[model samples]
Target: MEPAADMETASASTSTSASASASASASASASASASASATAAVGAMMDGRLLQENALSWPEVQEICKELEHLYRKDAQKDAARVRALARKRKEISAACQEKKNTAQQQLNQLLGNVREWEQQSNTAKARRDELAKKLQELEALKREMVAQLERVRVDEQSSKESLERLLDTYETARQEALKFQLEHRNEIDRAKHFMSLYAAVTGIKWDFSGDSIAGEIHIPRTQEIVPFEIDSTQSNDFETANALWAKIDAAFDALDNNDEL
Candidate 1:
């Protein structure tokens, strides 16, 4: 009876080990499939983004979407051009500032080396106090000049950094404009949503605001729709702009051919 019980226990252990191994194998296979799917999606994501960008120009892409977005991302392409120009200028200024810093450091190192050498000389001629004083005065003058130059360079660096930040802000706004262009040229829903988003962004209106309604911090005009009624007489610049954009949207849709898809 003892021998039979031992055999049964061994069989049970074998079965458990086999089951554990099978589970591990299945998990590994699933993990591999997921990784492959993710890799495939990642590989095509950039291409899809490009296509989306291209789809913005009148519902059909004519040029390379990447280049088009880079060149004309914002109104009149002015902001895009400014970003490129400012980026180059920032690089140049940064390089010049770095070079100035490096040169100042080198000059300081050389002066210190000279001071050490002078100290060695003064020790050899302990009776020559006047000569040592003259050398010390000269070293102090060099140190003062180097410090002034370094201070000027640091101030310039800081100013350039601020300008770069401003330029970056403009560039980001322009980039968002380009993204909107892509959405505007997409299907009908996206095209309409783009206008709604624009209205919200420009007017700071997050919720529904009819004419004569107050939305959080925004005071809206009385209207049954998002746009103000008879916007021609509306004193609000935001409504005027929204109405203009909405007009263009309507015209574009009206001009679409019967067989044309978004």
Candidate 2:
């Protein structure tokens, strides 16, 4: 019975050793598969990061996804559908992320474009304002010049008017003086005419005046003789002689008159 017990113990120990070895082999296999799955997950994470970092085109991203699907199918046959589905989900996630990034980039581009346009418009407005300011300055200068010129013209006109008025006053004075002289001269001439007519009618002699002297020739009545005589009224000291000569003429004229009456 002891020998049988020893054999039974040996068989039990052998079965236990076989079971321990099989268990160790299965655990190692499982560990390797877990490590491979972990490595593949890490690789997929790195590939996803790479895809995210690079600005790849859509076709390039699609080709990379197909390659990852093929690799996943070869690595995990039993979980092929799940791996394919995960790859498809990753592709969709990448596409969504890429689309979101593209939308953000487009929005940034539009904002930049708007800013540029606004800057351009601001520059244009500034230029227009500067041009208007320049024109206003020129207009102000022109107005000042015009005002100055008008003042000068006014001054010139005032000066000319004053001069013309002075000339008119001078001409008026000259004309008045000329008219007074003419009137005095005409009165002198009329007095001289009246004296000459009185002398001729009263003395019965044709007389002519030379300055202040009188000269005439007279015919004696009933005689064929004429007497010529001259008198100088300008000689004041010879007035007595002039009176004697006039008395003699009167006597001769009286004798002639008596003879004519007889």
Scored by TM-score, the top model is 2
- Per-residue lDDT for 8 in model 1? 55
TM-score computed on alpha carbons, candidate 2: 0.39
Residues 35-70, candidate 2, lDDT per residue (tens digit)?
A: 588668867865786778766677876776777677
Error of 2 at 179 (Å): 2.0
Question: What overall lDDT goes with each candidate model?
Answer: 0.59, 0.70
Highest lDDT: which candidate?
2
lDDT of 1 by residue, 75-174 (tens): 2354455456555655655565565556556666776888899989988788577787999999999999999999999999999999999999999999
Clash count list over all predictions: 5, 0
lDDT for position 25 in model 2: 51
Off by over 4 Å in 2: 1-91, 188-262
- Global Cα lDDT for candidate 2: 0.70
Pairs in clash, predicted candidate 2 = none
